[model samples]
Target: MSTHSRTARSGDRAASALAYGVVGLGLAFLAIPLAITCLMALDARTFLGPLPPPALSLHWFERLASRADILSSLRTSLVLAVLTTILSVSIGTAAAVGLARGDFPGKATLTSAFLSPLIVPPVVIGFGLLLFLSKAGITNGMARLLLGHVIVTVPYCIRTSLASLLGADKRLTEAAMILGATERQAFWSITIPLMKTGIITGAIFAFAISMDDVSISLFLSDPSATTLPVTLVSNMRAAFDLTIAAAAVILMAVTVLLIVVLDRLVGFDNVVGQGLFRS
Candidate 1:
């Protein structure tokens, strides 16, 4: 081969190696803290210490059962997340259908309005909701939290559902209608089935976001009833221990399980592409 061609090949190899190294470093930066947290949870020592603990134990996990506050908050978080996912997806799917299939004045403005929650800062949304809901006399903690989470999570549902509706084959619905199928029948049998992936993807996003939300939950959480994230933050302020690490690891495991389930039911790549804006 010519020297110039050999030099170009060498440069390409060097560039590839550099890119791989950068990616490795980025992954390590993200993964290392999680590794440390997991390890800390397993450590039998009373206090945080160096990595690779001298002894390993499930002491903290066992203690979690006895921690009534933690258990209650966890249950609250789970229930809230499920409710938020259902409500967000329901509202979002209906809005998506209307936005995608209808033509009307202020349509663009309306779409922007639906997605505005995503652009607005969470703190601002939380504080604003707190004031608005309190003045409206909806002072129940769980009720307030449900409303705030729906607002935050619905935007994701809308985005994914809208993408699905826009990408779906219009011909199928039209054919159904031409074959004596009413619009409602065509929507239920044809459009909804086609939009299933998007709906599922949106539900997953909504559930995950609702579970992890702390900022908004903090503002709306009642002293008597709190979500896991808020509970964790409160405990951190009062006291910190390896039990916290265990709780975090459990939370991480739940998130990982969710992704695994999604991957099993709907191919991860397809979900990511359709739900995460790549579509």
Candidate 2:
């Protein structure tokens, strides 16, 4: 090759390397806070004080087990998330199936409306829910919290399930119907199974959204019933330490486990590919 051509190729390679370095640095910066939180969970005497932990110990881990409120909060979060996952995934999946396959008047408008929960700010949704629920005379309890979680999680279910529905063999149901199968039988034997990955993905989204929610959660949490994130927020305001760290660690662990399990249940890459289709 000519000297000039080789020189140009070298310059292009250098630019590519520089771009990769910049992207890697950005990702590292984003991950730093999570690393700090993980480190704090290990510290014996660190909480809300500083970025770096001063001492490392497991004293706080033991303390978490003994805290009655912590246990209660865990139970509340689990129950709320489980309920939220079931409700949101079921409704969202049904809507997604309709949006993707079923033809009806106002389908476009209905699809857009169902996803509106994602576009609205949490504070707005929370306050609006608080007012509406109070007016209906069910205020300041698990019901209020559950409703808020359902609102937030439904969007995720729709988003995931819609992709799955679209990626599924669109003609499979028709094929089954042509073979003398009733619509219900066709859906049960063919359609639902084909869309299982997306439905499962939406369920994961539901759990994560419900458990990690704080802004909407804060508005509805009461003294008698508080979700885990609300409990952590309240605890931090009163006092911060390794206990909070342990709690934070547990939350992260649960989230990561859920993601892993979901991915295992359905190949994660397939879902990603399916999602890309809807957009």
Candidate 3:
């Protein structure tokens, strides 16, 4: 081979090596904390110590099982997340369709209104909702939490769904309608299928965000109805313990399981590729 060709080959190999090294470092940065948390939770020792824990046990998990308050918080978080996901996806999808397909005055303004939550600080949103809901005579704690979560998560759905709609082939829906399919039929059969990738991607993101939210949950949560993240924060204030780590692991596991189930049912790669990574 020529010297120039050999030098170019050497440079390509070095670049590939550097790329792989960077990716490995990025993975390590993300994984190390989670690994530490799991190890700490499993540590047989009651007190926090150096890495590897010296021993391993399920003592923290057992203690976590005995904590009624934490368990109740977990249940509350799950219910709230589900409700938030449903409401946000519905509202956001509808809003996205309208904003994308509708031609009317102040369209840009309306789109901004829907997405305002993303730019606003969570603390501000939470406090504002608290006062507004209180004055509106909506005193139910669960209702308040649900509303707060839906507001925060709806923006993500709108963004994903809108992106999908923008890239979709409108001719297919028109073709269906021309073939004697009613507007609703074309929408449900043609447009919905086209929009599915965006909708599902948005729903997953909405679910995860709702599950992990603490800032809005903090203000909206009552003693009777509080999310797990908020409860964990409160517990940390009162006492720091390994049970917290166990609870965190449980929360992480639940999120992962739900995502896996979704991937199995809907093919997450297809959904994400079509929605977020589409060229």
TM-score (all chains, Cα) for each model: 0.95, 0.91, 0.88
Native-to-model Cα distance after best TM-score fit, residue 144 in candidate 2, in Å: 0.9
Task: Report the error of model 1 at residue 77, Å.
Answer: 0.5
Candidate 3 lowest-lDDT run of ten = 270-279
Residue 85 C-alpha lDDT in model 2: 94
Query: Of the candidates shown, which would achieve the greatest TM-score relative to the real structure?
Result: 1
**Model 1: CA > 4 A from native:** 274-279
As a whole number from 0 to 100, the lDDT of residue 81 in candidate 3 is 87
Q: State which candidate has the highest lDDT.
A: 1
Clash pairs of candidate 2? none
Deviation (Å) of 148 in candidate 2: 0.8
Two-way TM-score contest, 1 vs 2, winner: 1
The reply for model 3, stretches above 4 Å from the true place, is: 1-20, 271-279
| Model 3, span 106-190: residue lDDT tens | 9999999999999999999999999999999998889999999999999999888888888887888889989999999988898
Off by over 4 Å in 2: 1-7, 45-55, 274-279
Tens-digit lDDT track of model 1 for 80-123: 99999999999999999999889999999999999999999999
For candidate 2, report its TM-score: 0.91
